[model samples]
Target: MKKQRVVAFVPIKLNSQRLPMKNILPLGEYSLSWYIFDSLLKVKDIDDVYVFCSDEEIKKHIPSQVKFLKRDRYLDGDLVKGQEIYQSFIESVDSDIYILSHTTSPFLAANTIEKALSKMLLEDYDSALSVQKKQTFAWFEEKPLNYELNNIPRTQDITPVFIETSGFFMFRKNIFEGYRRRIGFKPFLQEVDDVEAIDIDTKEDYEFAIQVYEQVKQRAYINN
Candidate 1:
C-alpha cells in the first residue's frame, strides 16, 4: 500500500471586517499567519503546507518552504464563510488527509498537531477537532443550557462543555466528499489548554493573546 499524503491546510484572506488586515498584523515576533505557519513547519507528519489564501502579499511573511493555493475569486471577500472556502478547497485539492490550521488561532503547537494526527489515524477517526473544556454556567435565551435551575451544580461539579476553538482540525481528504463538510461523523474532541485555545477575532482578543503568550513563554508547554 502507498503511504498516505497529509496536507496542512491554512485559510487566510487579506481583508477582515472586525480587525482590518489582521492576518498580516504583527503578533509577538511574527505576523498572525506566520505564527500558524511557523508551528506547522515544525510538524514532521505533514508532507506539505499549503496556504489557501486570496492575498498574494502573504507570501512575504510566511516561510519560503511553505506553498500557496489561491482561493476562489468569489470566496476572496469577507462575506464568505470560512467553511465555504474550506469545502471549495477540498473539492479542488487532492490528498489522503488534511490538517486544517487557522491563522486566527496562533497558539496551536506543532507537537499538538502531531499527536492529533497519530491518534486520528491509529483510532481510525473520521475527524479530529481541537476543543477547550469550558467549565462555566452557560445559558441559551433565558434557560440554562448545561444545568437545571433548581438543581444548580457547582461550577466545578458542572460538566464542562467543549467549544470548537478553531484551533485545528484533522480529517481524511475524502471525509468531506460524502459529508460536504470538514468535520465528519465520529469526530474526536482533542482537548487542548485554555491559553492555547485562544482565538483572535477582535482587537481585545488579540491583546489578550499577546499577554497570554508573554506570560507563558517561560514554561514552554508544548513539545520541547
Candidate 2:
C-alpha cells in the first residue's frame, strides 16, 4: 500500500471582535499563534504545516517550517461560517488526511497529535478529534442533562461526558469531501487533559492561558 499524504492547517485572521489582535498578542517569548505552529511542525506524521490566512504579514511571525496559504478576504468576515473557510482551504490543499487546528489551542502538544494519527491508522478510524472528559453534573435548558434530579449520584459514579475541544480535528480527505464535515461516520474520541484543551476565545480565556503557560514553563524549568 502506498503511503498517504498527511497535512495540517490552522486558519488565522488579523482582526478579532472579542479579543483585538489576539493571534499576534504577546505570549511568553513569541506571539500567541507561535505555540500551535510549533506543535504542528513537531508532528512526525504530518507532511506539511500551513497557516491559512488572508493577511501577508503573518508570515513574519510563523516559523519557517510552516508554510503560508493565502486565503480570500471575504472568508475572514465575522458573519462567515467556519465551514466555508474549511471548505475553501480543503479545496486548495490536496492531502489524504487533513488536521484542522486553531492557534487558540496553544498548549496542544505534538505527542497528542501523533497519538490521534496513530489511532486512526492502526484502528481503522475514519476521523479523530481531541476532546475533554468531564464527570461533573451538567445541565442544559434548565434541565439536568447528565444526571437525574431524583437520584443524584456521586460525580465519580456519573458517566463521563466528552466535550469536543477546538484543539484539533483529524479526518480523512474523503470524509470532508463526501459529508462536508470534519467528523466521519466512525470517529475516535481522543480525550485530553483540561490544560491541553484550553481554547482562547475571550479576554478571560486569554488571561487564563497566559497563567497556564507560565506555570507550564516553571514546571519545565524545575524538571530540567
Candidate 3:
C-alpha cells in the first residue's frame, strides 16, 4: 500500500477588518505568521507546509521550506468568506490529507498538532476538528443554556459544551470531494487546551492573545 501524504495549509490575508494588518503584528522577535510557520514545520509526520496570502509583507516571515501561494486582490476583503476560499484551495492543491491552520493562532502548539495528526491517521478518521470543551454559564434570550435557575447546581456538574476551535483542522482531501466541506460525515472532535483555542479576530482578542502567549511560554519553560 502506498503511504499517505500530509500537508498543512496556513492562510492569512492582508486586510483584517477588526484589527487592520493584524497578521503582521509582532510577537516577540517574530511576527504571528513566523510562529505558526515554524510550528507547522516541527510536525514530523507532515510532508510539507504551505502559506497562502495576498500581502507581499508576509513573504518575509515565510521560510524557504514552506511553499507560498498567492491570493488575488479581489478576495482580500472582509466580504469574502473562509469556506469559499478553502473550497477554492481544495480544488487547486493535491494531497492525501490537509492540516488547516491560521496565522492568528500564533501560540498554536506543535504537540497539540502532532497528537491530532497521529489520532487522525491511526484511527482512520475521515476528518478532525479541534474543540475546546468548556463548562460555563450561558443564556439564550431569557432561558439558561446549560442549567436551570431552580436547580442552582455547581458549574462542574453541568454538562460541558464543545466549541469548535478554528485554530486548526485535519481532514482527508476527499472530504472536500465527498461533502464539499472541510469535515466529513464521521468527523472527530479533537479537544485542545483552552488557551490554544484563541484565534485573533478583533483588536481586543489580539491583545488578550499576547498576554496569554506569554503565560503559555512561561508555563512551558517551568514545566521543562
The CA lDDT of each predicted structure is 0.83, 0.92, 0.82
Best by lDDT: 2
The ten-residue window of minimal lDDT in model 1 covers 215-224
lDDT of 1 by residue, 1-224 (tens): 57778888888877778988888888778888888888888888788998988777999978888998888678977578767888877777778888888888888877888888887767778889999888999987998889998998988899778889888888887777776677888788888887678899999998888888776775665534
What 10-residue stretch in candidate 2 is worst by lDDT?
A: 56-65
lDDT, residue 52, candidate 2 = 96
Candidate 1 ranges beyond 4 A from true positions: 218-224
**lDDT value for model 3:** 0.82
- What RMSD, rounded to one decimal, does every model reach? 2.6, 1.1, 2.2
lDDT tens readout by residue for model 3, 107-157? 778888888888887887888888998798777799888888888778888
TM-scores vs. true structure, each candidate: 0.90, 0.96, 0.89
Clashes of each: 0, 0, 0
Clashing residue pairs in candidate 1 (N, C-alpha, C atoms within 3 angstroms):
none
Runs in model 3 lying further than 4 Å from the true structure: 140-142, 148-153, 216-224
Per-residue alpha-carbon lDDT of candidate 2 for residues 82-125, written as tens digits (9 for 90 to 100): 88998999999999999999999999999999999988877789
